[model samples]
Target: MPRSLPPLNAVKAFECAGRHQSLSAAAAELGVTHGAISRQVKILEDWLGTGLFIREGRGIELTVDGRQFLKEATKLLDGLALAAERLSGGPKSRVLRINAPQTFTMRWLIPRLSAFSVAHPGIEVRLSASIEPIDKITGHFDLAIRRGAMGADSTPFLSETCVPVASPDLLKTTPVSRVTDLTAHTLLHAESVADLWQRWLDLAGYRKLQGKAQLRFEPLYHSLQAAIDGAGIAMGPSALVATDIMAGRLVALFPDLPLPLDDFHFFVPPGAATRHVRVFQRWLLDMGLAQSPRPP
Candidate 1:
């Protein structure tokens, strides 16, 4: 006997609406209007000859039937997605999407991405850089790299330490033999690391010292570039500016006063881990460990 089924579109509408418990949210997720979701859900309810949702205060709630149906619908959708992926030449050929902050992506990850591509030629990587927080449920990214305290769902990747850095040219032109000499030079600030200078000063026992000229930038990378261009002294994260320091582009100031900062973490959406995701995760961890500063 042929299995009787409702309209696939209607089923999809119901599934998404049921999961979110809001027709508007479902519409947004499906890239449709609220009326479209409502109409499709109504069609599904009519086809089944039952009420799947109950009208509530400015929203809808899934009925008992809706909850049960949602479980089966979700399973069916997952199976369909898996089948499609398998039929499309499996996971190796799939694209992996990653979201990260702009500064980190530009100054740290982008430089090392060629190695990842060379290692995993079969998996194409798409990187998006933004400072906005990602919604785990609605975001399209497979993985996200964030800086801050690690949450329960995040995996710790790298810790950060900040030190004052200046272009070699700037340091030469404005030589400083002591920490207080910074008062004679410009101070570069990255809005992202707003309190870095203050933290460093507090640690260096120079609580009253101030910059002769202060320059502020919205992004950390901008401040780093300014420091490299001999504009001013900027507090730099070791992980992001180590290559510059080693390459003689920037010189670390008061190396003995390194200020510890927040760590970096990786987060994945809730679901079974794909082989490609696992591979990328391992590669990221390995690269982080390699780039991290080694103790003396």
Candidate 2:
């Protein structure tokens, strides 16, 4: 005689709820209602004759049995997904999920993504903007583009230099012929790169410039936009501001004083690169190289 199995929907509800530790979160992930998830979980608990969760004040905790069950359930669910994906003819119409910073997405990747789309019509690219560091083990990201020194685990894609930029109109109004002339105008600052001005100033041999009117933004994208709108001079990374400079929207101030900054790197989950990921990576690297400023 064969052993009977529990309800798949109830098992799924328990697995999702156990992983998130919140029925609401599980409901959101599964595209179901809170009550539905609660009912399914209750049914699962009754079938097993064990309490899976300890309900607390607006929260739930997994019991020992629940924890052990979740571990096994997760493995089983993952295996099922893998089997389904393989049987469905893998990589035929896969979605490549990419997470990158707001500044990079706005000024760099989004602008050039159309070409990638044109080239690979079958592969869909989904982008999510985040400045927080990628957590490979827990995150649902295929690839992450970040600006920093490349670690042993990451691959460097584009090297960058930091330069001051402002709208052409602003440059005309407040002529900055030399480094010291910047003292007369507002200095736009991005919180992410707060010390960029100081670093650029140091490179230009201006150690003791007096305080100027300053406008600070939390993200580099906001500061870049402010610079483009003639609000103030901003420290622009070469990889990000190249297109703006070429288009005559923003003018590079003191082009001679370029400060070497961290290169952009591509981080992927630990595994062999899939066909979709490999093609995208190649396209991005080529685009970055082409857009980089040529040596004079």
Candidate 3:
């Protein structure tokens, strides 16, 4: 709503000229003549009441005002291009909304989303962060990956094991030469299941951690991060945390294993299953099996 305005073609000319810092170069890129580029810049300068370009031989350079406008103009055109591409790409994906705890989102699923996207390019997977357990029946989620018991009718995709892990740095400085030594250091607790740490401790026959205040975490993934950062040791679902543990980011606290908990299940809602969901289910379970750690 100012006094005057110039054509968009002039702004395009200014942005190209600023980027290449040459009118002849801008003309080459825009597939126009040097005279056309110069005329456009003149129109822009007339509108803004500024000297935008400097004549130097057969080329040109942007003035301070042209440089400033070029920054904003380039951004607008780039955004417009992206919008056009997405809109022209066709119908939006029918999203497969998923709900998972924040820790899992950060430490696990978020990292693997790129692989999932590569495997399933057509379907969009939307993740919702929820600490509370999700009920797939009434909810909009197509599937859920959760650490709880599931009925035979449920648990569609995969089942995974649990394993104990800590950082190598923790072992070097601390006096953790044996299983009994764990009693001295702080142990991470998945407080959601009051007996999770206690059970793992018992299975490994480690007694020192018996009454110590275990560092409680609502989500197991948080405890895993703490363990990796050398905060404390946490037992985690091996299927989920295996990649990191195997990569040596977090070390397996014990070589002796415990029974894998078949409790955690990936479930798709009954009657809502589709060909795409079935394909995703197969790929995920295969990936989990492929990711299992070697025995000591």
Deviation of model 2 at 120, angstroms: 0.2
TM-score of 2: 0.67
Model 3 pairs whose backbones collide:
none
Model 3 has an lDDT value of: 0.67
lDDT of 1 by residue, 1-296 (tens): 99899999999989877755667656655667889999999999999999999998767888889999998987887688768777988755658898899999998899999999888787798998876676643367887888973344566567779999999898888897799889999999999879999998999999879989999999999999999999999999989998899999999987887998777887666542455675687688678777774342
Each candidate structure's TM-score, on Cα atoms with residue i matched to residue i, is 0.68, 0.67, 0.60
Deviation (Å) of 278 in candidate 1: 0.8
Best candidate according to lDDT: 1
Give the per-residue lDDT of model 3 (tens digit) for 1-296.
67554688998888766755657545655667878988998898898899987777765667777778877887886676557647888534557777666665676678888988876676788887764545533466766666664433334233555656788888777756577677667788776555766677767766335424468887667788888898877787766676787788877755566646654456555544444454455566555545552231
Candidate 1 minimal-lDDT segment of 10 residues? 269-278
**Residue 148's lDDT in candidate 1:** 72
lDDT of 2 at 261: 90
CA lDDT, every prediction? 0.82, 0.81, 0.67
In model 1, the runs with Cα more than 4 Å from the true position are 1-92, 293-296
Q: Write the per-residue lDDT of candidate 2 for residues 1-296, one digit (tens) a residue.
A: 98888789999989877865777656755667889989999999999999999999877889999999888987887678667767988646768989888889988999989988888776798998887767643356877888883344455667889899999998788898888888888999999888998988888888777437999999998999999999989999987898899999999887777999988887665442455675686677677667663342
Comparing 1 with 3 on lDDT, the higher-scoring candidate is 1
Better of 1 and 2 by lDDT: 1
lDDT, residue 135, model 1: 67
**How many pairs collide in each candidate, listed in order?**
0, 0, 0
